[model samples]
Target: MTWTFEEMDRMFHPRVVAVVGDKKDRDYMWLRSVSTLKGKVYSVQVNPEEAANIVAMGFPNYSSLLDIPEPVDYVIVAVPRHVAPRVLEDAIRKGVNGVMFFTAGFAETGEPEGIRLQQVLTDMARKARMKIVGPNCMGLFNPRWGLRHSPEQYYDDGGPVGFISQSGTHATFFSLVGYQHGVKISKSASMGNGIILHADDYLDYLGQDPQTQVIAMYLEGVPNARRLFHLMQEIGQRKPIVVWKGGQTSEGARAVQSHTASLAASTALWQAAVRQANALWADSFDETLDLVKALCFLKEPVGPRLGLVAMTGGQSVVITDAFAKAGLQVPLLTPRSYQELATFYSTIGGSYRNPMDMTPTSRNLDMVRRVLDILARDDNIDAICYEFNMGFSAREGMVERLVDLLGEFREAYPRPFLCVLSAVHREAEAVGVRQALAQRGVPAYPSFQRAGNAFRKVWDYYRERRERGATRPAPAPAGPVRPG
Candidate 1:
């Protein structure tokens, strides 16, 4: 069944969130989750030492979940397994909608008794009509509603990406990339083990979520493969679903099982499943983030042909080879277009090929604008890949010009235009350049090859959708089209 707005809303924005835990966990949950949460937040701690400090962080600290004088709509449990069952018991008794278990040691322990205990807990919750998020999970983070994974980790300006991961570290890292890449997290859930709510549950909620335009998942294994596949296909028809299936290799599969108590699927089988569901797949954690950033910032390209404008002849040759290697075409420039760009080229060097090179002497915002404009008007190319060395550009103070030039070029050509900002020895300098480009709606990569590879994935996704006769949405009025 699909998640209704009301149910999901209550799940994320519980009116009274009871933070159920003790000792070190009490501080961790309060500092991490409760610090940024909305509604009436109360800590249900067993720390008698600090019991008198009821107004710690401006929230009352109670002895137990039942002791919290108000009606608790949700419970965030971080207690031990022995103590955790009682918290769930009290939450059900309190008529709470859900209990998010921050504690581990149930089925993932691989013990018969531990497995039996989880089953009993699920049965108890089911009888009370209560929902459980995880036996070993970090729970949800909805920034729009003031929920967060951790106050120190989550960004306040959450954007359109809603991520659901089987790993907490993956979810945390994914959320942080937005700060550097300009992608944002509308909502996310680090669903460890996924004992109760499951990956499919979060997918169902995000599918109907208005704030979420792109659904990204980092999964170790599938609980119900058939159900997950059909659900992804149904939702993927409307929105882009990027899945990064972890543990494709046998060694990695063993690690994944140990990590999340999940048996990983084979690489070939999982890949076929993802493709059949019409969802995009990423081979690594970094690639998953890159794909999400590309989807969030880029306008759909109508064709696969690329226009590469480079700083030097060597860089141009490298970019051309990179795009070609990535299965994207770097077509020869049209005679008319080549003639127009050749006007800005110096007498020393340049090329009229697909990856046209411009002399350093001619590198400026005005010339870059003209070159980009010439390429944009060409029917031979559908997207532009502008490659530049930012660290070296600082010599001519062209770095400032390139920054402003990215905005102007993007405004003029509202199609998919990517920037390849080469990283020099200085890591901080590269970060500044990347952030600047991200602000202008351009997805930047460390190398031209990486940028081209990401763009190729975007093209292939739309191309596959077209072959299947599915609807592919665009940022503008024109949707994804092929070269007829």
Candidate 2:
């Protein structure tokens, strides 16, 4: 059965969240930050000394989960591995529905005792009909709710893209990149070892989450292949799922085995999983994030017809080639759009064909805006792709001009607009400019190749959703789309 917003909402925005374990300085900060977003937090620790400072950070301190006066909706356990089962039992007796075990040293230790411990936890959870997030994991972070779980303080609030990663560092890095790259998080969880809750659980949750527009995963190997495949099939029908497996090489596979006690499984099985789930296999973290970001913003391109507009034909030719490599259609501009853009600038020496290159001409906001407007309005065009680089023309408020052009284009055109601002700019300026552009519903990337790849994914997602006769959840008026 498909999960709904009302159901999923309770999972993230729980009425009361109880955090178990002595609050270390780091863990306390993470807990406090997340508590700020929504919900009341009951800090549970055995030691009153440790809980004292944590209680001061805007949460009530309790000796144990059962001691909390209010009903705890979610519990995050960060105690020693040996102490976890007891704490989990307490949480269960207290009727906690969800628990995220952030402590490590279960199965990942590669000892028989560790494996046994994990199995015990799993068995207890199943018998209790309670859901466990992780036993050896970094845990989850939902920016919309102010969760920064790990020591990683990255925040990508209200973004449509959601991530599930095996690596804690990957979880932290990707979230940082999502913040840096203009991608937002609906909800992100790092399932370090699939002791109890596997990737499939979070995948299923994100599939049903109203805030999540697209899903991305950094998988080492599938924990429960059968369940994952079924979940993927169902989730893929509604939204795009991009996965980047880490254990590809023999050495990498060995690392994954030791890191998470994850079996690499057969290559054939992995390949089949990709196809069966209808999931896109991304090559790297950048590609995974780029594609997810694209899917979050752009709609399906009508056809392969990509209308490329750049400051120069060289840039256009480069983007066209990248588009082809990314399996995108590079449709030539129709006569109407071509003629409309022609009124604004000279074509110089190059042919005035599709990748409309307004080269050697003064690069002004009106010139770029008119080109984007005309191309986006074209009946033959499916989407508009443009490139802008700093130092090429930074004078005369170039950033402001680009931002204004993006604003006007969004107002005039209804199709997806993919922009590539490949150069490095000041962080403050870039953030302001990007925020402005994103406000108008445009998706921007750091490079032309990335822009092309993003557009391709967006097109695929749009097509996939259309084929399934599904509609995207109505996104709230937020910069990043968050699944409710």
Top-lDDT structure, candidate number: 1
Per-residue lDDT for 363-409 in model 1, tens only?
A: 56677777788889898999998876765576665776787788668
Best-fitting candidate, scored by TM-score: 1
**Candidate 2 per-residue C-alpha lDDT over 113-175 given as tens digits, one digit per residue, 9 for 90 to 100:** 888888889888888877777777767777766656754454435677789999888887887
lDDT for position 242 in model 1: 95
Model 2, position 90, has a per-residue lDDT of: 92
Candidate 2 residue-wise lDDT at 301: 59
TM per candidate: 0.92, 0.86
Off by over 4 Å in 2: 1-9, 24-27, 47-49, 55-58, 150-157, 329-344, 347-351, 377-380, 425-428, 457-484
lDDT (C-alpha) at residue 436 in model 1: 71
